[model samples]
Target: MAEEEAVKLFGTWRSPFSRRVEIALKLKGVDFKYYEEDLTNKSHLLLKYNPVHKKIPVLVHNEKPIVESLVILEYIDETWKEGFPILPKDPCQRSHARFWARFLDEKCLPAIEEACLRSVDREKAVEEACELLKLLENELKDNKFFGGETIGLVDIVASVISCWLKAFQQVAGVELLTKEKLPKLCEWSDEFVSHAVIKGCLPPSDKLLASLRAHFETVASKELCT
Candidate 1:
């Protein structure tokens, strides 16, 4: 395939979904072009490739576009099989990984967002977030990573918590994830971010904090105006 036609990723820096795809590609040693999208004024190509949602982290390979980060991760893994595997070879283990990844999206993320944004029921949001984190903490149960001894699909999917959640909590004045509350998960976060591939993918800490702070404040002001 021609270099330009091989692989291209449309993504934004602040999006964990985007970063997960980048990390998966790097893990598989796939060389690709990255187009950073201006979400506020999304590019024509982004919309054309992902018109259904128009969200980023789209992976276009050989003229075929793969939307949704989880699906993109699996595509990158299946297409590039020369390197470390992202999903487990065993069907049962692979299903387990997919289950937790879904829980992170469908259950955990919403609660965390509610708590961070300080919505109408702040205390309930925080409690639900903590409960979900505890379940993840139990799941970890002494594994080095969610993938067991190496970064896998779950770790990549949970990168938002490892790299972005603490900063978001600090900016929003919420502390749902803490050493005191969930020690094993906290340790996993440290290991996940400190991993060489993940470290390279993360935005700088100060920059992420500033951006999250500004985003939260803007949301708060808008709520007050309403």
Candidate 2:
């Protein structure tokens, strides 16, 4: 790929989904220039490229825009088939990887956030999140990483658990992932954050804590006043 080919990524600084694509590109040795979009004031280019969802973490390669982080990850893997393939080679394992990735994004992350926020249905939220997390814990029991020995697509998608979840847990003043309760999951989180490519982009705990605390307070005030 020529320098002028200009792989451009539109994303926010703290977004794990964006980081997923970014890390995938780096792992594949693809050079990309990043545009940090202010989510408060989304860019016209982002709107033009990803009109339907109008979301950040859009990947523009060779003047083509790919929306949704998971889809973008697959695109990156297939396009640059040179190093560290994200998905497994076997058909069955590939499907399993995709399934778990979707499960984390669509199910586990939401439940975990809801449990942390405890905004409504607190008990149900906590139970649901714990159940999902237990499944993940079992998967990680015999493996070093979600992908066995190294970080893969599922590991990339699960990155939020290591960084954002810790920040959110503190801000929400909740105790969901304790070292004793979820030791394996906690261990995986620590390992993930300590990994080289992931460590660089992991958000500062203090920064996220402040931001999330302010956001929760604002939301809480709105709820109380209403």
Candidate 3:
């Protein structure tokens, strides 16, 4: 693709969904322009492109918009299918990859979001969060990555969990994915984040922690004063 024909990604720094697309682009060695969107006041282009959900992490290829992080991931893979494959070539392995990716979306992502955003029952939320982490720990026990030895589709999806989990731990004042509790999963996270592409795409840990602290405090104060 020529310089003008290159892709353009609309996203936010803190959004893990956006980060997924960013990492995929870097992994595939695709040239693209990044446009960060402010969720508070979303840009006209974002609204115009994704009018339905009006969400970030929209990828524009040749000016055609693709929404949803996972959907965009599949699109990226298919578009540059020749390069480093994110999804496996074998039919069974590809199905397994999709299963885990969907699992992260259906189960893991929601649990983390609830733990971070909902404050009606703080203790219950933290407990539920730990349960989800335990399930992940079991799934990751023997596998180096969700796709086995190398990082793949499911690995990318699961990687988002760490960022949110870290935020939750800071806000709730509890450590769930510790060395002693979920050793392998914790180790996997350490290795996953160490990848140059993923590491460069992630937001600063301190900044994410501070944002989570402020968000939880705001939610907690509002609930108490109400």
**Best candidate according to lDDT:** 1
lDDT score of residue 45 within candidate 2:
95
1-226: candidate 2 lDDT, tens digit per residue: 6942579999987788988888888878888889999988999999999999999899998889999999999999888888888988888988989999999999999998788776777888888888898888888867878888888889999988888888887877676677877888898888888888788777777877888888889888998998
Off by over 4 Å in 2: 1-5
TM-score per candidate: 0.96, 0.94, 0.91
lDDT of 1 by residue, 136-197 (tens): 88998889899999999999999999978889888888888899999999999998988888
Candidate 3 pairs with clashing backbones: none
List the candidate numbers ranked by TM-score, top first: 1, 2, 3
When summed lDDT is taken over every stretch of 10 residues in candidate 2, the lowest stretch is 172-181
Q: Kindly give the number of clashing pairs for every candidate.
A: 0, 0, 0
Q: Rate the local accuracy (lDDT) of all candidates.
A: 0.90, 0.86, 0.82
RMSD of each: 1.4, 1.5, 2.0
Off by over 4 Å in 1: 2-5
Q: How far in Å is the alpha carbon of 176 misplaced in model 1?
A: 1.2
